[model samples]
Target: MELALIRHGQTDWNLDERVQGRTDIPLNETGREQARTAAELIRADGADWDLILSSPLQRARETAEIIAEATAVPFGGVVDGLIEQNFGEGEGMVVAEFYDRWPNRDFPGGEHDDELGARGVRTLDEIVGAHPSGTRVLAVSHGSLIRGTIARLMRTPYKQVPRLDNTSISLFAHDEDWRVVTIGGVSVAEAIPTTV
Candidate 1:
């Protein structure tokens, strides 16, 4: 099995550096181009994709649609499990401002960072397990979820995983064992950092 994990293209919140957890924002223009370019790169590499799984969010779905259109691949619509981690009341606020509001307090009800990481791992496990042998899945999701999934798969600390760029592709191949091909494409590799 092979998984192509892609982060959604840039959104307005991304450009503004706002906390966009659970927000259904659409992709910006640059994000569309990035998705297209990513699809082109995949096609150039001649990768045979067997399935397309995308987050329910508009941004990720939109990006996935574009990629599917470009590659002429059919998509398995909106899997809620692949959605971004919920930030509760911090949804739209700037990260710094959100921290200012919370100050020295922490959110309750398994709302901590660790809880989110665990949920992400569980979701990823379910998604990955659903595929059969030799199945290739293209998953379009948010940066945090993708990072969490990568960390879980690689057996690294969640906090240690590198930030994923918009529309970046992280490949994981499974046969007897799992392998992370390139964190992102060669060009994106230079622009972004990888955990391992």
Candidate 2:
């Protein structure tokens, strides 16, 4: 199975640098355009996806819908496990201030890193298991979730994972095990080691 994980497009919150967490923010005009650009990139990449899936959040769902429409790919319903991490009290705070207030990156009552990582991996397994071998799937999700999932798959610390840009894609392939193919359009060999 091959999977392409995409981060949702920009939102007002994203531009304001607010901690979106579980907040359901809609995409801005630029965000919609970004989705279109992402679709074009995927089309140019020449890898057809069997279906597109996304988190239930508005930003991710809308991005998926736009991509599906642009690419004529099937739209699979949202996966609950693909939802963004619950930032608890950090939601809506500016990222810089949030870090100043919580230097350890722990928000009061926020979803823990381990929990998010486990959920991300489980979601990946479920998606892969439900699809036939060689099927290509695209999933639209949040930055933290994407990064955490990749970090866990590579057996690296979450902090070591690079931040993903809006609408960026990370590709993975699974045979006996999952392996990183590319990240943010960069080949795995150029971005990071294929295996830790």
The Cα local distance difference test for each model comes to 0.76, 0.89
lDDT per residue for candidate 1 within 1-196, as digits (tens), equals 7787899999889999887878789899988998999889878989788778899999999999999999977897888878887777777888788778866325332245556556766765676788777778898988877766666666666556677789988877666655567565443244245542
**Model 1 regions more than 4 Å off:** 96-111, 176-179, 186-196
lDDT of 2 by residue, 82-168 (tens): 999898999999999998999877778889777888889899899988888888999999999988887788777776677789999
TM-score of 2: 0.94
> What's the distance in Å from true for residue 118, model 1?
3.0
Per-residue lDDT for 142 in model 1?
87
Lowest lDDT 10-residue stretch of candidate 1: 187-196
Number of the top lDDT candidate? 2
Model 1 Cα displacement at 161 (Å)? 1.3
